[model samples]
Target: MNPVATWRRLLAELLGTALLVTAVVGSGIMAATLSPDDVGLQLLQNSIATAFALGALILTFGPVSGAHFNPVVSAADWFLGRRTGTGLSLRDLAGYTVAQTIGAIAGSVLANLMFDLAAVDISAKTRTGTHLWLGEVVATTGLLLLIFALARSGRAAVAPAAVGAYIGAAYWFTSSTSFANPAVSIGRAFTDTFAGISPGSLPGFIAAQLIGLALGVGLLLALYPDVAAAAEKVVIPAERAARRQRAASRR
Candidate 1:
């Protein structure tokens, strides 16, 4: 594996999370500040925009970094035996979590600055509850199903589109605006601005998403038992072929 590339991938995650959070919170604030009349419409447009950007980013950088924009996705991939380098180091998880959270908070702050809304809490406008919980299940399940289809078909090439479309559609169809990510959920909680989950809403929302992720992985695996075979081999071996050859000659 390219060690340099690995670091680059991690940095990409950092940058990607920043960009995602910025766009998401920015759109929400714009809706509140500008199109308050049709907040729903604005949110829909925002969701589409975010989904497209995320999809394109994943397509562009997936080969280099696996395009794991969400911590949950990274964790899921590791759980399913995709990312195998020491398998989720505590230090890296902490670093990634901090990066995602910071990026999220910075985005909200920037949105606040741009909207000039007198430090209003952004979470007030968010949707959550048992309804939101069910939405999480629906949205995340759709994501996992789409991903499972792509992987099992040996269509890793189409993963980014599959994932993006799933999220985009889930946003509307599920009645919850489809977060489907734990890091993003926590980040959004810091604000009471547009698209911010009410501070009171964050914990249950996070729990729902985590549960959805677990169930999604489980369901996808159950449905596609052979999905792992289609996965690209990135395993590191103990011996180099040249070393094996020299040993055979010595023997």
Candidate 2:
């Protein structure tokens, strides 16, 4: 891809991630405000809003940067595609991760400002414990498995809905409420709202997510030895935009 194309991809990752975090944090705040006494109702509202917004974001940005929005997803793409040379290069991976992280932080700050809260209100909700860590592991593992499995099956078209659905379900099933993305985990630390995760709990949650990434790779390899062929198209057809750019340039 040309330099311009590369920059476009990075920009898509940044904006897509920013919007995703905005939906997460903003919806959480809205839910809390609407259902102050009913925590369960708040969670339901948050999850539903997040799921719908996530699916829409993926559809919007998938063709550009694969809609990764998460460092773990980008890392997994690199790891799985390294041998076959079909996925993101090391440089691209680094760029995507950085963009996603910055976007996450920016989104959180924006959400806080929207709610009339301090821009850097650090989370006080302490989420720790081995059980919670286990939940993170499971949530991350399941997320990767779902994404890669869809790729391997040549079903990337459904990934937007599938991923959104999985995350929405994970929120209810997992003890940690499925903060499966490292970038998201870090972003939520900036808010004291219902979706926030305390900074102190970040290390353990991130570690578990990394571990889950490894286990997910192992499982994918075992289940589909030829999965490398689809590694570049994890959440969607990442090359579609590039192909369009190349074609337009030729004309």
Candidate 3:
């Protein structure tokens, strides 16, 4: 395979995140429409669709950018690999973050337009309370742990299925329905559908996710003492890096 370029990596992150958000918001709207009277059924439908879409997206984009659709994930990669220079550089992390956020917003607008709703309807679904915040922390922590653990264990090949499975399960287990991703949360705020979060709730949820990042770092240190060595392969191996190694070996 050809080495992936920086622009290709950024584009992968942008497109992957956009599609992920579209799946989330779109499925929620479809679920609500299909099962108007049954909230439980709607949630199930939404979760299933999101899970499948996420796994497919990761598989499609993993080699290009390591499939980091979440800002915290990219941050974690940079932090862990700073000493070793194995994971993303600071510049790459910044680019990925910007692309993911912009893609997420665009995704929300697209979802809304598809459903015949206002293109930029701000969500009014205020999700508050300490419980919800705590849920976000738990969800984020678990997600980080899973990703890092898989990388460290050399099981990154299964990340698509594993990550998708975890998020799907977290939806039912976490009170906040596993809005562990800040970009996703921000994108969701642009829609007033079942997956939407009020703009007012962004602060608390984002803070909780940050806290989760801290805790995840601590836990990863204990669980995978040398996780930094595997940081470059977190979600998947970057195609450019992998190609460079092959070229050096052949030389």
Candidate 4:
């Protein structure tokens, strides 16, 4: 990719991720503040906000950077593209991941600042145990499956709504409330709030998410082998435009 294009994509990833984390952390704080006595209401409020914000963010940034906003999704795209040479290059993958992580952290800090709290604080909420890990696995597996399956089925256009809806539902259903994204998980660790997770518990959550990612890839391979072409359309708008141009030239 050209330097300008690469920079644009990176900026998209960073800004998208930062906004996403801000939604997650900020909504959690707002919900907790407003619904101090009702845990269920707090969760409901937070989940709704996150779902809406995610969908909007995806719609805004999907055309520019694919709107991954998650490390696992980016890695999945890289892995799927490796064979067909239609996805992100190794260098691009690295850039996306780094940008996402930084964005996530910045988002956490921004949310804290918005609430007049410290910019960075270690979370005290300790989310652990086998059941939680299992929850993480299920949440992440479903997330990956939904993403890749949509890509394979030529329904990438609906990703904004579909992904946001799935995540919103997962929040209520999953025991861990679906911290499926490693980058998001790390960001949440920086806040000591209703949605925060303790730093010590980060490893287990990330490991489970990785396992889920693997399972998602395995299932996609087993069921949608022919849809590898669709996988190429997961994101990366520049490539999509290039492909369209090539087709236009042929016509």
Candidate lDDT (C-alpha), each: 0.65, 0.88, 0.89, 0.87
Total clashes, candidate 3?
Answer: 0
Whose lDDT is higher: candidate 1's or candidate 2's? 2
Q: How would you encode candidate 4's per-residue C-alpha lDDT over 157-242 as one tens digit per residue?
A: 78889999999999999999998999999999999999899999999999999999898888877888865565567665635645
Cα lDDT, model 2, residue 45: 95
Q: Give the per-residue lDDT digits (tens) of candidate 1, residues 60-162.
A: 6555455556666656555665544433344555555666666666666666677775444656754657988988877776776676566556455566677
lDDT string for model 3 (1-251, tens) is 21468889889999999999999999999999999999999999999999999999998999878898999898888888889887788998899899999989989999999999999999999999999999999999999999988877766778899999999999999999998999999999999999999999999999999999999988998888899977877633455445545685799
Stretches > 4 Å off in candidate 4: 1-4, 238-251
33 Cα displacement, candidate 1 (Å): 3.5
- Residue 151's lDDT in candidate 1: 52
For each candidate in turn, the TM-score is 0.78, 0.93, 0.93, 0.93
Error of 3 at 135 (Å): 0.4
Our model 3 lands, by Cα RMSD against the true structure, at 2.9
Residues 45-65 of candidate 2: C-alpha lDDT, one tens digit per residue: 999999999999999988877
Error of 2 at 198 (Å): 1.2
- Spell out the clash pairs found in candidate 2: none
For candidate 4, give the lDDT of residue 104: 95
Q: Each candidate: RMSD to true structure?
A: 6.5, 4.0, 2.9, 2.5
Candidate 1: clashing pairs of residues: 121-192, 121-193, 122-191, 122-192, 122-193, 123-191, 123-192, 123-196
The model with the greater lDDT, 3 or 4, is 3
